[model samples]
Target: MIIESYSFGRMKVDGIGFDSDLIIFPEKIVSSWWRVQGHYLQVRDLGEVLDYQPEVLVIGTGYSGCMDVADEVKKELEAAGIKYYIEKSSRAVEIFNKIDSKKKVGAFHLTC
Candidate 1:
């Protein structure tokens, strides 16, 4: 999937715009992703993505990068052997647009 544009509180992915946060899988988009703790990411927040077992996980931590992914969450991904990359939402959009993988997933927070 291609992420066309991203801004605070909104994003366009594969030509569809979304106001809420989202997760992009190889086959579909999970359009209403909300973490248990807003602005803080958790492994439980990515249950659906983990279920699909993607080779890589990309996280967009809002427009200015106000959100955070906890150490425990990083540990979980490492233990599960799932590689991850995290950056500001705009930069993430750039990476998502260029990445090439058979099964990579993206979780993007639309606002700070």
Candidate 2:
């Protein structure tokens, strides 16, 4: 899917807009994704992504980078041989859009 644009609390992907957090996979978009810990990311929060077995995973830590990715999550991704990039939502959007979505997935946090 192509991300047409991104702004505070909003994102347009393939002509559709999403106002809540979402996971973008090659096959479909999972909307309104919520983590067990609101501002922290853990391995358990990435079950779907892990199952997808993407070559790359991009994480958007919210509009202002309020969210933090836990170290354990990093270790797990590395162990699984999944390359990943963590950035604020805006930059993450750029990275996601530039990649080949066929082997990539993105988890985005729309708001702080």
Tens digit per residue, CA lDDT, model 1, 1-112: 8887787899988889999999999999998899999999988998998889888888999999999999987898888888888999899888877789978999999898
Give lDDT for model 1. 0.89
| Position 20, candidate 1: lDDT | 98
Task: Kindly list the per-residue Cα lDDT of model 2 for residues 1-112, writing each as its tens digit.
Answer: 8889999999999999999999999879999999999899999999999988899999999999998999999999999999999999999999999997588999999998
Give TM per candidate.
0.95, 0.97
TM-score winner: 2
Model 2 scores a C-alpha lDDT of 0.94
lDDT of each: 0.89, 0.94
Q: What shift in Å separates residue 104 of candidate 2 from its native position after superposition? A: 0.3
Question: Could you report the Cα RMSD, in angstroms, for every candidate shown?
Answer: 0.9, 0.8
Over 4 Å off in model 2, which ranges?
none
